[model samples]
Target: MEKCRFHEVKVSAPSKVILFGEHAVVYGMTAVAASLDLRTRMRIKPHKSRILVNFPDVGLKESWSPEQLKTLFQHKPNTEILDVNYVYLDLIHNFLKTESSDLRMASVICFLYLYSLIMDEVGIVPMEILVESEIPLGAGLGSSAALSVCLSAGLIGVLHQVQGYEKSIFEYTSSSIQKEVCGFAFLSEKILHGTPSGIDNSISTYGGMCRFEKGNLEPVRLERNLRILLINTNTFRNTKDLVERVGEKRVKYPDIVKPILESIHAISEQFLTSIQEYNQDLNEKKFYKILEDLMDTNQSLLTGLGVSHPTLDDVCRTLKKLGIVGKLTGAGGGGFALAVLPPSISGKTVLVAKDLLETKGYTCYQADIGVNGYVIEVVK
Candidate 1:
């Protein structure tokens, strides 16, 4: 338990969206996901005797002494097994009973767990962490995963300083560091969302587009970057609840639900293949058509899964009327819908679409798809 040489550490990780697959990916189906420019940033520095976290996005600002956190957990996490330590989490829940919001409490619990686990490598040292994020919370976007990845990388950056590593191994540029961050972030996500597909964290870690099946990630190469308009429904939904609902539906009618899942899986594969084969010089219009069609079918299947909300349908309809196709990007219910913006689309059309959506009480964000993932820097 030595002190770190660096004065502070900073890290950022991108949020992600399901480009083609959603709940279907959880069933060992191949799904496509990509990183969004939206990101969460975390900064960590030494404190006197308390570990503090200030996450203003959720209106959470809390502190706990090292001894206080230690007493709440049975032991440090086992790295080999990244599963949620229910015994420890239950203890944390009991300790944080005073916290009114479950979301905020879950964030604290995850911070405590990761803090203790990472601190085990360098002993408990008091620190203060502040997170500022561009990503919206509980919007099907990987805001939680981005937070987890950024927090983990920042903590690991501290470890790098303490261990006297000449170069920071926790930096996002390295593939190894990406894998490490993804693993820790996945565990943190499990604390937040009970049954995350691990797709969000994976895309957030490695960046670009990827094909995810079960827990495996295969990065996909894109000939040209895709543009998207992120439409926020401004309606919050519990991802765990929606996922569980789909699971229950499957259990009640496997014959009916299995086929939908299979169809969605096919759509994802087709989406991937279409993107890979796309050539702007040869047939640019055809590429957009293929992608738009896949999005339409995927949204339909998500509707059948009963996750799509009326507002989501409204979003799709609004975008489709403008010759732009869109679908719910995350767990449906009501989060964010992604609308593809073909290169040929005029800026005026995008503005018109945004103005129309805004009038309907929705927020829109313009960002490039498949952007870089996590990045870290140690401040001396």
Candidate 2:
């Protein structure tokens, strides 16, 4: 492979939201998710022979030498394809030791892990990788997934330029590159969420609406556009804690919680049906009506699982007063709640809702459903 002539590569990935089926999605239920307007962007440029990373959100700046990083991986098989496994992670754990417990430091570890693995095939060249995020961290908005996707996509993008990727008769198209990026992001997520459902990374890498069922993803179409109001509670909530609490409830009250979970599953099905109806040019009002009722039921089920917090309830109540259909998305202890607007919702109504929620001590913003997934661009 020839060396790259380009000096820099920049790539951006959109944040994602779970429209329906968050906790339920993890439990073999169907879930609907969409790409958010917010994005996390990554810019990479060649430097010396060391890896340098910049994460401004948390005041993190670090650099690592190629020799220092390679010891973390047995770098097995010495194949053309890059491979990452437990040996590398164990080595990384020992390398970071105390710092791995910190989220910021852990992310840096993940970045280097992915960086070294991908760059191995193309040969490592020193470079500066900078990240900037518009998505709020720890809000169940797929921030980590976006970052991972961007890194994988950015590095692979640079590889394309270095090896003269498009000159061959057969080469990867944009879609194939997206899947490859998502694959690496999935591996990286295992380090972030332990056992992730893959929905987050898939949506983050692809940037569109998806119906995830039993660990599989299929693209779903939206008939008419739906505008949503994403209100961040600004309240810190641990997704691991929330997911554990729900599991405990299921264990203690199997008879009681079983039906509720089933109901939640049913609601997801209903949500899918509504989308199909809307796509078929059916009644828009009727479709949103189904959504409103399902939101009420789904939120109630989440509350039963002990994932609901005061702030989440406050979000629901505020939206309820405005007659807007809202529910907590993702893990939902006290992170973010979504208010789905009606098909005929007026700008005045949206503004009023935002104003009311903001006045009530929440961060309110607007996003749309059914949007483009991910794209790569050259930085000139």
TM-score for all models, in order of appearance: 0.87, 0.89
lDDT by residue for model 1 (257-277), tens: 999999999999998778777
Tens-digit per-residue lDDT, 280-302, candidate 2: 87787887788899999899888
* Model 2 worst lDDT window (10 residues): 75-84
Q: What is the alpha-carbon lDDT for the whole of candidate 1? A: 0.84
* C-alpha RMSD (angstroms) for model 2: 3.0
lDDT for each candidate structure: 0.84, 0.78
Residue 21 C-alpha lDDT in model 2: 75
Predicted structure 2, TM vs. truth: 0.89
Model 1 stretches astray by more than 4 angstroms: 66-74, 77-80, 94-101, 170-172, 236-260, 279-282, 304-307
Q: Worst lDDT window (10 residues) for model 1?
A: 166-175
